[model samples]
Target: MDNIISKLRNLDAYPKINEDFYSRTLSGGVITLSSSILMLLLFISELRLYLHAVTETKLVVDTSRGETLRINFDVTFPALPCSLLSLDAMDISGEQHLDVKHDIIKKRLDSHGNAIEARPDGIGAPKIEKPLQRHGGRLEHNETYCGSCFGAESADDDCCNSCEEVREAYRKKGWALSNPDLIDQCKREGFLQRIKDEDGEGCNIYGFLEVNKVAGNFHFAPGKSFQQSNVHVHDLLAFQKDSFNISHKINRLAFGEYFPGVVNPLDSVQWKQETPSATYQYFIKVVPTVYNSVSGYTIQSNQFSVTEHVRTAEVGRLQSLPAVFFFYDLSPIKVTFTEEHVSFLHFLTNVCAIVGGVFTVSGILDSFIYHGQKVIKKKMEIGKFS
Candidate 1:
C-alpha cells in the first residue's frame, strides 16, 4: 500500500512546493484576488447553463397509417349569400363530400357588414303543411303522397318533399333547377322569396373537415355541386346574375390541434375580387411535427408552406364557378423535438477546469512580474539602468 501511494504521488500533475521557498508580494496578492473573482464568475455562468434545458431537433420518415387529418376553417364571404354558397371536398382516395352543412355555423351580415342573424347552417324553413293541396287538391287522403322530381326522378316511387330535395334530385340527374318558382315544393317553401330577402347579404361560414391523411382539396363556392362527364360543376343558374362578389377573408385555418410556437401561413389571409369573377387558390405543403418539452409535456401538430393564385372567370365561355380552393399535400418526412439538461458529471468536470486553469495562469503571470522587478533593481544598483 505504501509503494502504490508513492507511485500515485509521483504521477501528480501539480506537485506541492516547500514553504521556505514561497515568496509573497503586493502584485502577486492582487493577481491571485483577480483570478479568484474571474473563476467565481465563470463557475456561476456554467452552473446556470447546466441547470437549464436544451432542445434537440430531428427529421425522420413518417410511417403512420390509416390516420385522419382534421382541417379547421373560419371564412367570411362578404358578398355571397348563405342561401347560394356551398362547401365541397374531394380527395385522391375517391372520397367526396358535397354540400357539406353539418357541424357548421353561419352568421348573416347585411350590406354594411353588420351581423344581423346567427344560426346553425343547413336549416330550411318550416315544411308546408298539406303540400299536395297547394299543388292541385286532386289526391285522395288514403293515397301515398309521392311528389315529383319533375322528370329528374330515378324511380317512380321517388319523392321530393322539400324544395331542397327537388334541387338535389335534379343535381343527381345533372339537370339544373332553373325554374324554382314553377316547382310546387319550392313555391310552398318560398325558396324564391328567401333569395329575394337575402339579395344583398353576405355569409360567414366556419366549420371543420375530417379527411384522410393524404392530398386533397376543399372549396367554398356559390350554388350546389354536381358531376357531369367526370367534370365538377355548380348550378350557376340558381344564383342572382346581377353581381356576385367572390372576395373573401380567411380568419383562421389550421391543420391540427394547436401547439406552442406553431405558425400557419394562411391565417388572416384576405383577397378582394379584382375581376368580375375569379378563383382564388391556395397550394400548401404540410410537415408533421412532434414536440417534447422538458417537463414531459408533448405536442403533435403540423407546419405548412403555401403559394397562392387567382384566375379570372370568363362569362359564357364555359368555366368553373368563382370560388376559393385549398389544395394541400403531405411531406414524407416528420420533425421531432426533445429537451434535456446537462449531466452532473460534465458540470463538475468543467467547474474544476475553470478554477485550476485560472489559478495556474495567474501564478505564471505573478512569477514573471517578480523576476523582472528583481532584475531591474539589481541593474539600477550597478548604475546600468536609469
Candidate 2:
C-alpha cells in the first residue's frame, strides 16, 4: 500500500512549492489580476449566449394543399359615397362574390374626414307596400303580390317583389337599369333618391374576405357590378358625373394571423388620383411562413411584398371604371424559423477553454518579464549595462 501511494505521488502533475522559497513580484500579481478579469468577462459573455435562444432560418418548397386564406382589410374611400361604393371578389377557380356586404361595416365621412355615421350595409330599401302586378297594369289590392320583373324575366310567371329583385333580374339578363324611376318598385323605394341623399359624402369600408388559397383579385368600385357585352360596367344609379375621384387610404391589410417579426407593407398606404378618375392596382406576392418557438409552440402565417400601379382614364374614352384592385399570388417557397439554446456540454467546454488559455498566456508573459528585469539588474551591478 505504501509503495502504491508513493507511485501516485510521483505521478502527480501539479507539484507544490514551499512558501518560503516562492518569489512573488508586482508584475506577476498584475498579470494574474488582469487575466482573471478577462476570464470572468469571457465567461459571462458565453453564459449569456447559452441562456438566450438563437433563431435559425431556412427556406423550403411549400407543399401545402387545399387550404383557404383569410384576408382582413380596412380601406377608406375619401371621395366615394357608401351608396355608390361596392366590393367584389373573384379568383382563378371561377368563384366570385358580387356586392359583398356580409361581415362588413361602412362609416360615412364628411368633407373633413370625420365619421358622421356608421351602419351595416343592407340589400337596399325595405319591400314596397304596393307593388305593380304586371307591367302597365293597374294598382290592384291583391292578397298575393307578384310584382313584375318587366321584360328581364327568364320565365313568364317569374315575379319581382322588390326593387332589388328587379335589379337582380336585369343583371342576370345582362342588362343595365339605366332609369330606375321608370320601374315602380325602384320609384317607390327611392333608389335614385337614396343616391342623391348620400351625394358628396365619403365612405370608410372595413371588412374581411375569405378566399381560396389561389391567385385571385378583390376590388372596390363605384355602383353595382354587372357584365354587358363582355365588359364590366356599373349601373351608376343615374348619378352621372364628368369624372369620379377614387382617391383612397388603406388603414390595415393582413393576409393571415399576426406573428412575431412579421411585417405588413400595405398598412397606412395612401393614394390620390390626380386625373379625373383612375384605377389603383396593387400586385402582391405572398410567402408562407412557419415559426417554431423555443416553448414548443408553432405559428403559421404569411409575409408579402407589393408593387403598385395606377391606370388613369381618358375623359370620354375610358374603358375601365374607377376602382381599387388588389391582385395577390402565392409563392412556391416557404420560410421557417426555429429557436433553440446552446447545449450544456458546449457551454461547459467553452468556459474551460477560456480559463485555461488566459491563464497559460498570462503566466508565460509574467515569467519573461521577471527574468529580463533580473538579468538587466545583474548586468548593471557588474557595470556591463549600457
What is the TM-score of each predicted model, taking all chains together? 0.78, 0.81
Q: Report how far residue 5 has shifted in candidate 2, in Å.
A: 4.1
What is the per-residue lDDT of model 2 for residues 1-386, given as tens digits with 9 covering 90 to 100? Answer: 99999999999999998999879999999999999999999999999999999899999999999998889999998899887888999888988888888989999998889999999887765455656677555456655677888798899889887788888888778787888889888888887897778778899999788899999999998877777886667776455665778999999999888877888999999998898778899999999889999999998888899999998866687456789999999999999989999999999999999999999999899999999999988989889645
Superposed Cα deviation of residue 286, candidate 1 (Å): 1.8
The local lDDT score (0 to 100) that residue 339 gets in candidate 1 is 84
lDDT of 1: 0.85
lDDT of 1 by residue, 53-143 (tens): 8788999999988988889999999888888888999999989898888888889989988898988878474364566632356446676
Pairs clashing within candidate 1:
none
Error of 1 at 59 (Å): 2.0
TM-score of the candidate numbered 1? 0.78
Best by TM-score: 2
